[model samples]
Target: MLSTRRLRPSKNKPKLPDGVRIYAMTDIHGCAHLLKQMLRVIDADLARSRPRYAIEVYMGDYVDRGPDSRSTLDILIDRSRRGNTIFLKGNHEVFLGNVLRDPSLLTDWLRVGGLYTLMSYGLAPSPTPGDEERQHLVQAFARAMPRQHLEFLRKLRLTFTCGDFFFVHAGVRPGVPLAEQQETDLLWIREEFLKSRQNFGKYIVHGHTPVRSPELLENRANIDTGAYATGNLTLMTMQGSSMLAV
Candidate 1:
């Protein structure tokens, strides 16, 4: 069955260009099943709405945690090839790349669920890998990772802007201008961005810090529903000045 929840209209509703629709998603955390389910719902919604143009903005964290990280990337890569899609980099993805480049970071990466991702690529990661083991694991991962997947990860964007919304994996820095925002803050910031009431130039649509449900604040919207653990993956659809969570 189709699932959707209309957002309560805010006084100053953000608008999209006429006839364009955006389906924003975030924080899959390697849950391929949930991602597939959400994609089906988006497809159904698109069939019914048939807007002039549509864009799917993925807020990243597509790997790590849960299971099936490989399949998750497979699905997303395929989707991107099919049509209009924007992929943003998330902190977890940063960890993946960092560990690949510098094996010394494996211990830190494993703590935040990088093991699952390694396992999904058919490499069994030791819970506490030593320096030598870390190097071996990284080598194995490089061999196991598909060329396309590596390319996709390397090419991910930090932000995507469309009309009145700025899409990112995590919240932007509170005081930084959108163009001047740093990559670290864009992919990792939380407290300051969430706590501040400062108006970002555009309506911020992001995910990284998962919420019990989708939050549609006057300034921003968070669509991360902790899909890996809670089995709730959020897809926020935006068109004109209306937003709906599915």
Candidate 2:
């Protein structure tokens, strides 16, 4: 995998030009190649659009369930640091953060398919890898992982607003302001948000509860299509309320 350590950025990441139209992505479960494909499409669209703007918000899941979590995080951080990407936290990141806090959580994470992340970071499960081997891979991956990658995961915003839209990793708790949204629901919600029929006031774009394609609900959209699992990536064009498959 391409090292992400070099891709990490320093403090005060630059902001995007919010006035321009945007294209968003979510639940990128470590499919590094698919992300490249998506970027190519975004570039083509940007080149053709009048006035030439770029993509904006992206929902997260940059790790786990795929072959190249390290590469995936590296690319997203690189693009966002370039000032045209907005990233929201997904449940996978939250789980990784938890594991970092308590390595014992590795079982829970492993149960949820986080072994790919451990492998990306150069760690192993049962009969933990030998020290020399572990240290070599760890140092290599650590050196390559962008520091901002962890910072990005650490300070990931649960909710953000751009124009009339509110973007989150997962849906908000019903009746809660974007300001008061619970982090748990933001990263892990599925049912309550899915079952709700009322308008959520501001339109929400999120990824969670994977589908074959973007699931367009009356109030929000699910951009997760389980790309890593199904070899399909779903995207929503911020240019308008439209879905694009890559």
Candidate 3:
């Protein structure tokens, strides 16, 4: 069953370009099955209400935690190549990149669900890998990863702005300019950005912290419903000044 809701209009409405519609999702966290379902749902929506222009924005964490990180990336990469799509970097993606360069980080990364990702790519990860084992695992991962997947990871954007909305993996710094936001804050910050009631110039759309349902606020919206564990993947729609979760 599909659940849909129209966001309550804020005092100062943020609108998209006329005749344009956006389908945005966040924090996939390796749930390929859920992602596939959401894509089908989006397709059905497009067929029902055709828009002049449609853009899909994925606020990342495409890998880690769940059963099929490799398949998740494959689907996303294919979708991006075939259509208008924007992929933002999430903290987990940063961790994955860092582990490739500094194998020592694998210990920490594994603690936060990196093992599932390794398994997805056909690598068996040791729970407590020493320096030599870590290095070996890194080499194995590099060999197993597809060239296109590496390219997709390397080319991921930290943020995307369209009309009156700013899309990112995590929330942005409250006072910092969007252009000046540090990668750390864009991919990881939580409390500071979430607690701020100040207007952020343009409305923000992000996902990092999970919630039971989409949190539609006056200044930002969080659409990560913890799909990796709960299976409640969220898809948000934006058109003109209207926002909907479908």
Arrange candidates by lDDT, descending. 3, 1, 2
Runs in model 1 lying further than 4 Å from the true structure: 1-3
Show model 2 residue runs off by greater than 4 Å: 1-19, 50-53, 127-146, 240-246
Clash totals in order: 0, 7, 0
**Residue 12 in candidate 2 has what lDDT?**
24
Least accurate 10 contiguous residues by lDDT in model 2: 1-10
Query: Sorted by TM-score, highest first, which candidate order results?
Result: 3, 1, 2
Better of 1 and 2 by lDDT: 1
Lowest summed-lDDT stretch of 10 residues in model 3? 1-10
Comparing 2 and 3 on TM-score, the stronger one: 3
Best candidate according to lDDT: 3
What is the lDDT of every predicted structure here? 0.91, 0.70, 0.92
* Candidate 3 TM-score, C-alpha based: 0.97
The C-alpha stretches of model 3 lying farther than 4 A from their native spots are none
State candidate 2's TM-score: 0.81
Candidate 2, 12-130: lDDT as tens digits? 22223444576888888888998998887777767787535655677878788887888888787778777867777888888877765655555567677687876776655453444
Give the TM-score of each candidate: 0.97, 0.81, 0.97
lDDT (10s digit) by residue, model 1, range 35-56 = 8998998898889999999999
